[model samples]
Target chain A: EAGVAQSPRYKIIEKRQSVAFWCNPISGHATLYWYQQILGQGPKLLIQFQNNGVVDDSQLPKDRFSAERLKGVDSTLKIQPAKLEDSAVYLCASSPRRQSFFEQYFGPGTRLTVT
Target chain B: SQQGEEDPQALSIQEGENATMNCSYKTSINNLQWYRQNSGRGLVHLILIRSNEREKHSGRLRVTLDTSKKSSSLLITASRAADTASYFCATDAAYGGATNKLIFGTGTLLAVQP
Candidate 1:
């Protein structure tokens, strides 16, 4: 079975520039998530989507970061006017469902380097 | 915020040796999971232990959870060069009416020499 898929394995942008990343989760999975991993640090959850609806986004930076999963199969995460601190790997993961415990399948991730 | 913190930020050992990593968390959790990430790659789930369970074994990996101490440990026996990677422990905390979220630890960088 194919795993989660992400686009643009690597990205570089200047400070204040905008950047966007895309994710296509595993087939039949009902839950999707976006996480940010800084160098030498563990990944932090940014947002979660359950079938076209947001399940949690309390940690998301409302001012600069936004994500959407319109059809519940694919999702996109955007960061506008990026900052130096935004230079980190963006990971996308998917699970079978949200109502129970299930292992998450992660994508290769997009490594964003903001100069 | 990271829910768990792994001890001994890094470890180096020769092949065929045993490697152990510990993780401690602050809040109550439903389950704890371990994941491995190779250089510049995404994380792969290694094992998961529910709070009610004490220990679980999967091949060369053994996981022990102590809820009373709010800590968990991962033991990899007969480690190999292929086991060189970063191991992270993630906690699944229940919130907002049965929904859960996973918060990862700082990670332990393991280097196994062949």
Candidate 2:
């Protein structure tokens, strides 16, 4: 089976610039998640979507970070006026709905660097 | 803001040795999962242990969950240089529907010298 897919393996942007990252979940997976992984830290959940509807996004910095998973298959995360602190790897993952035991398939991630 | 906490922030071991990492979570969880991330890459699921299951195994990976203690452990037997990566434990909070919004730990950086 094909794994999750992400675009632009690396990105470098100046501070205060805008950037967007894209993700396509695994085939038939109903749950998708976006996580931010800063250097030397674990991934932190930024948002989650279940079939086109958001399930959770409490950690998302609404002022700067936004994500959308329209149609439930693909997702895009955008950071506006990016800050130097925003430099990190953004990972996308997917899993079968209602299966907490199901393992999540992750994408290669988009590593962003804010100069 | 993190749910799980992994101990021994870093671990270095000779190839062929066993490496064990522990994780402690704050809230109750329906399941716990372990994942590995290579530098500059994404995470790969290693194993998942349900709250009811005490242990699970896959290849050289063994994961144990002790819900009573809100803790879990991952043991990798016969580690190799290829296993060098950051290992993280994630928990699915027991509340709400199963969205699989895993809250991850700080992670344990493992370096296996061959």
Q: TM-score of every model?
A: 0.98, 0.95
CA deviation > 4 Å runs, candidate 2: none
TM-score of 2: 0.95
Instruction: Write model 2 residue lDDT over B17-37, tens digit each, in one string.
Output: 999999999998888999998
The candidates score, on chain A by TM-score, as follows 0.98, 0.97
Q: Model 1, residue A2: what's the lDDT?
A: 90
What's the residue-level lDDT of B84 in candidate 1?
A: 96
Error of 2 at B54 (Å): 1.2
As a whole number from 0 to 100, the lDDT of residue A43 in candidate 2 is 90
lDDT of 2 at B70: 91
- Residues B46-82 of candidate 1: C-alpha lDDT, one tens digit per residue: 9989889999999999999999999999999999999
Report the C-alpha displacement of residue B107, candidate 1, in angstroms. Answer: 0.2
Clashes of each: 0, 0
| Off by more than 4 A, model 1 | none
TM-score of chain B of each: 0.95, 0.96
Worst 10 residues of 2 chain B by lDDT: B94-103
